[model samples]
Target chain A: TQLLEQSPQFLSIQEGENLTVYCNSSSVFSSLQWYRQEPGEGPVLLVTVVTGGEVKKLKRLTFQFGDARKDSSLHITAAQPGDTGLYLCAGVATGNQFYFGTGTSLTVIP
Target chain B: DARVTQTPRHKVTEMGQEVTMRCQPILGHNTVFWYRQTMMQGLELLAYFRNRAPLDDSGMPKDRFSAEMPDATLATLKIQPSEPRDSAVYFCASGLVRGVGTDTQYFGPGTRLTVL
Candidate 1:
């Protein structure tokens, strides 16, 4: 049973502040994905990082995969009120099984 | 934009009752998954199907939980003699997995079930 742990389970910051969330696992995964889920809605895919040391940017959000594929990070630049939501990292292991992180609930105060 | 659909957005049932949740996968998708979300456990995959076949269900409680994909478009998760602890939001996702880990699953709105 593979497990993914996320840091800062709850985050509350003022608008325009920058924040970073981390996801770590002991097991190596084939790929990792970041998702943002708002209230009353299912999670929406943010970005998928496949290779080690890969980095993908989606506007103000930047994602990075660990060199060993055992960890990942999401960094939001100049965060705004609309960027507040639950941030989750999902790692895909062998056999197509996905292990989700504990989740980080972010609140950007305006 | 094609999206997965689920029925009974909200359900409140008494304990020991049978609860059934349904999902309709997006068109052209062969992979389907069922997940349960709670504050404690976050999001846990209960079961998944590939090409309308059950692939893995080890995450689900075998004693009282059952999941089946009757057809390409529909998947169902049922719980018999439901308990209060079973309250959670159940989500259904569909994807087209081509390689080892290239699939991007699209999730449904989820069914919020509260067992009393």
Candidate 2:
């Protein structure tokens, strides 16, 4: 089974603070996706990183794919209370198999 | 925006009863997946279907749980003789697969099930 470990399982920060969540794996992936889930709702896709050593920015969020495609990261700049949610990273391997991360719960206090 | 819809947003039932959850995927999608989420296990894929044909169901408990996509737009998951341990949120996701590349899966709101 492929494992996607996420760091800082729980995070609480004041509004406007910057934070970064990391997703790491020993096995290489074809693509990695980041999602944000609010209470009582399913996860919503945030972004997908396909190429190695690639970086994509969406507003205040930046996502990076590792050179080996075995890791990824999500950095949030000037986070607001609306950013509070459970962040999950899912890696897709060969045969379109998906492995989800342990998840990071972020709470941005206003 | 296209969205997946699920029925019985919440369900509370007694142990040993049968429970069924339904999902309606967005139009034009060709793949559907069933997943279960619990506090301990997070999210796990229970089954997957492509073009209404089941592709994988390795993550499901063969004896008590069953999943099926009868058509392109509808999917269902059933649990018979449910147990308290079966209580959790069940989600259905749909996407269009292009070759072997990664596909973006859109998930439903999920059905929160509780077995007493």
Candidate 3:
């Protein structure tokens, strides 16, 4: 089974701080996706990176796929209170099955 | 905006009881998935269907857990003789396509089940 492990399972930072979360896997993935989920709601897709060494930026959020397609990272710049939530990284294998990471719970204080 | 819908946002039942959760995928979506999330396990895929046909259910327990897509619009997950370990948030997601390259899944507000 393909497994994705996320580091820094929980993070607490002040507003305007920058933080990075890592997702690593031993298997190559066809695509990787990042999602942010608020309490009481389902996860919402933030970005999808399909190519190795690809970087996609959405406002203050930056996502990077590893050069070997075995890892990914999410960096948030100037995070605000609204950014406090659980962040998840999922990888899609050759068969289209998705494997999710352990997740990182962020608490952005005001 | 199109979204997946799930019934009974919250449910509380005793052990050994039957638990059923339903989902309605977004219109035009051909794929649907069921996931379970808990404080310990995080998120785990239980089953998924494509074109109203079950594609994979290896992650689900064969004995007590059953997943079915009775129609294109509705999917159900049933657990018989549920145990306390079954208490978790069950999420239903839908997607437009089936492949790994471009399929984007849209998730529904999860059904929180508590088996006491």
Candidate 4:
């Protein structure tokens, strides 16, 4: 099993709809990161959450770290076609071990 | 913008051939990482180096895969006698690991390898 698991593996939503993506793991992390990747490109860093139960906002997107630091969530307000891409979450475990989740591919239809 | 750059955005080679992928990390970045992305495995870490020294390569198939950093500016991943199963999009990323959780890893465009 992967150290990190993200679900709905695939998401398709209409414009203006709100959606959420979840990343879960059995192991606690020192921190978690979110990245967005488009086709023919690399993943770009979106946000990094360090403290447990931390909540960060990036414009229309809201990111939250679970109270146990073993999970995270990403929520988008008023999704748009421009938001179509693959969203991946990464975990930083003890001893600086870093790993990425399988990722959630979201398609925002206009 | 100082970003990671990888050479030969795409590569195609026959089985048993040697394939070399190169990466030029962002200046002053102390950590270099190699990853392979496939439909099934997602993004798997092949190896990583800190301060030009290999820290971990457990995720790589040591039989045919090799990773090296000749200098701070350059990193390389080599696959000798690559098989069709080795085909995937390989990415190179560089970051400054300050032991702080907020450090960011900047990724390259990635090399699409197709072993025939």
TM-score of 1: 0.98
Question: Which is better, 2 or 4, measured by lDDT?
Answer: 4
| DockQ per model, Cα | 0.83, 0.76, 0.83, 0.82
The DockQ-derived docking category for candidate 4 is high
Q: In angstroms, give how far residue A85 of model 3 lies from its true place.
A: 0.4
Q: Model-by-model lDDT, in order?
A: 0.94, 0.93, 0.93, 0.95
Docking class of 1: high
The list of candidate 1 runs beyond 4 A from truth reads none
lDDT of 2 at B83: 97
Residues A11-88, candidate 4: write the lDDT tens digits. 999999999999999989999999999998999999999999999999999999999999999999999999999999
Clashing pairs in 4: none
Each model's TM-score?
Answer: 0.98, 0.97, 0.97, 0.98
What CA root-mean-square deviation does each model show from the true structure? 0.9, 1.1, 1.1, 0.8
lDDT of 3 by residue, A1-110 (tens): 43999989999999999999999999899999999999999999999999999999999999999999999999999999999999999998865788999999999999
On residues A25-104, what C-alpha lDDT tens digit does candidate 2 reach at each position? 99899999999999999999999999999999999999999999999999999999999999999999887777889899
Among residues 3 or more apart in sequence or in different chains, the pairs in candidate 2 whose N, CA or C atoms overlap within 3 Å are none
Model 1 chain A scores worst on lDDT over the 10 consecutive residues at A92-101
- Give the 10-residue window scoring lowest on summed lDDT in candidate 3 chain A: A91-100
lDDT of 1 by residue, A1-110 (tens): 43999998999999999999999999899999999999989999999999999999999999999999999999999889999899999999887778899999999999
Alpha-carbon runs more than 4 Å astray in model 4: none
